[model samples]
Target: AALAQGRQPLLLERTAGLGGRARSLFARDVDSMIDNGQHVLAASYHETRRLLRRLGQENAIHFQQPLSIHFRFNQRRNFPFRAWRLPAPLHFLLPLLFGAPLSRSDRRYLFRWGRRFRQTVPEQLKPLTVRQWLDEAGQSPLLEQLLWEPLTLATLNTPLRQASAFLLYQVLQKAFLSSAATSGLGLATRLLGEIFARPAEQFIRQQG
Candidate 1:
């Protein structure tokens, strides 16, 4: 953006790599590249998308359509949760109501909670633990195990008992309730180096 605006921007990397923790390494034995860690981007990551587009590497990221989740519980049991092509909140609602593995009672609880969540603001949430908030919200144990716990771990990198409820609420609000596209998952098809680092380096050198 700075380059486009005729302004010079200097990016300093403390480490040898540009991506920092979000980097890739070649596995010579398999002749393939692997990431240091699993990184999935939500469509709501506007800044990241903008940067990728600026670097002309937007197509390097493969995005899933309609936002679906497949859960493998065991070797024999797997559950598929698919979002419908409905508008805004209905996209979230129809999915959880009809597609998810929740029981009737669980669905009812979640529906009521969703209504409450829409009405409440993120700042209004207390600094309670995620587990405490879930309990207070009457989240079912199955729902917690199947959805909330995993999401909490992935997003906050902390256990639900330790993660802040306010932060989790903010994530949910931005990712799910914001828009249909916001919830779409994007996975980088190329190595992380090819996806961002190499292009960024080239862009910087051209600017110089």
Candidate 2:
């Protein structure tokens, strides 16, 4: 924001790396550089995408359109989660209806909750935890294990029992309930050091 306002911003780093917590490391055991953390980017990450665009590192990320993912339950079995080309909600809904290993009761409960979710505002869920919200929504243990738990862990980086429901709802609104294009999954083509930290540092230097 400071740079956009014609100000020369001075970036200071306490550590030697640029990306702070989202950085890379050289492990002697591996004999190569590796990311300290794994990051999965979503198409709904508008601000992040904009920043990468500004850094001229847009090509460093690759997006998978039509929203396809494979979740492995065991070495022998996996679930294929693919969204339809339909509009918002339906794209995700149809896939869940046909592809997911959900019981009829789970489906009914989810549909009811989906209606309530659309009607309620983010503030309404402010006091609730993700686990509480799911429980109140009549989410089955199987449903929670198959979908909600993993989704919450991946997106919020917080355990379901502790993560705020409001934030999870907002993520659902933006990443899944939004348009198909926004729901697509994106991944960095390179390591965090090469794709983000190094490129961002170079960008800042060039701006000066």
Candidate 3:
């Protein structure tokens, strides 16, 4: 960003490696490269995707067309959630309303929160945690167990009782409500170091 703005940015790294915790290590025991964690990406990350394209590493990450997720509840039962290729909100809304494993009454709770999500400001949600917000919104226990709870953990890496409602709202808005394409999941096809860190460092040094 600094370079794009005609500014020379000085990078200060405390460790020898770039990408911080998003780096990869060669595991001789496993005989393969392994990332520190499963660093998943959302297609909503437009700027990051653009950067990958600029670096000619666009193929390093693979994205789904539209959005789809399969939740395995048990050994036999599996729930598939797929968003249509429609516009923003409708893509996910159709699946949530008709296909989700929720009772009709429980699905109705979406209307209230849907309105609130559109109307409420960040300041109004700042004091509440995700659990509190869901409770106040009359979200059923089943809905929380199946959808919101898992989503909160995956996106924020925090428990629903501790995660900020405002943050959760922001993530949902950007990743799901913005556009159908944005809701898709993206996974790196290569090692983190090769896909991002090394290429990024090389690009930066060459520019400097």
Candidate 4:
């Protein structure tokens, strides 16, 4: 809003209230919202800073000083079997080096997988699940358990069995093949911001 412009953009909120989902109670002593589960803000998550900054609460939001990721497995879900790197390879390689989850053969599978994925995509939307491709490429169950699950769910929000292998492959290429970090820049931070806001806060407040 401080940005100087020839024409001021019209801003509106659909809801009667101003705060949207993260609202506040009438009194300063009250709390507004509580998210059910834990979430993270990556160092690379740019505008998150801007929003938090705008609210004069940037310091309040805990930015992962040294960003990290976690891998959880079925039923036990005890703790993340391990952590991963937010940017990608640097995070992945540490574990591979220490053999936290991936073994020597698993590492080879990852290398081969990256090389192969580097080569296809929206240009070639093949009909194979990532699991299928990995298995065919000789990846084992252990490899799938350790390396693939976190990515399948977290990155794409779908299971390997049902999700598009091509889509996941594209994500890998964008994250690993191109840049040092998948999240360096140019990625959309909030789909809602990009897609809405004539009355965005209104919709959020009243959202089901």
User: Roughly what TM-score does model 2 have, to 2 decimal places?
Assistant: 0.89
Relative to the unseen true structure, what is the C-alpha lDDT of residue 34 in candidate 3, on a scale of 0 to 100?
92
lDDT of 1 by residue, 1-208 (tens): 7887988887777776787666777779889888767777767777889999989999999877667778878898777877677776778777878777789898898788778888876765667899988888878888998889877876666799999999888778777667777777788887888888888889888987
lDDT of model 4 at residue 125?
A: 58
Name the lDDT of candidate 2. Answer: 0.83
Clashing pairs in 4: 14-202, 15-202
lDDT of 4 by residue, 1-208 (tens): 4223334345454655343433222334444332222233434445665665544444544434233445556676523333254445545454454645556777776666555654554544577887676666686787677667766765665777877778777665554334344332222233222222323344334442
Q: Is candidate 2 or candidate 4 better by TM-score?
A: 2
Task: State the lDDT at 134 in candidate 2.
Answer: 86
Clash counts for all predictions: 0, 0, 0, 2
Kindly indicate the candidate among 2 and 3 with the higher TM-score.
2
A best-first ranking of the candidates according to their lDDT comes to 3, 2, 1, 4
Off by over 4 Å in 1: 1-14, 26-32, 125-129, 153-164
Per-model TM-score versus the true fold? 0.81, 0.89, 0.84, 0.49
lDDT of candidate model 3 versus the reference: 0.83
Model 2 residue 81 CA deviation (Å) reads: 0.8
TM-score of 4: 0.49
Candidate 4, residue 47: CA error in Å?
Answer: 10
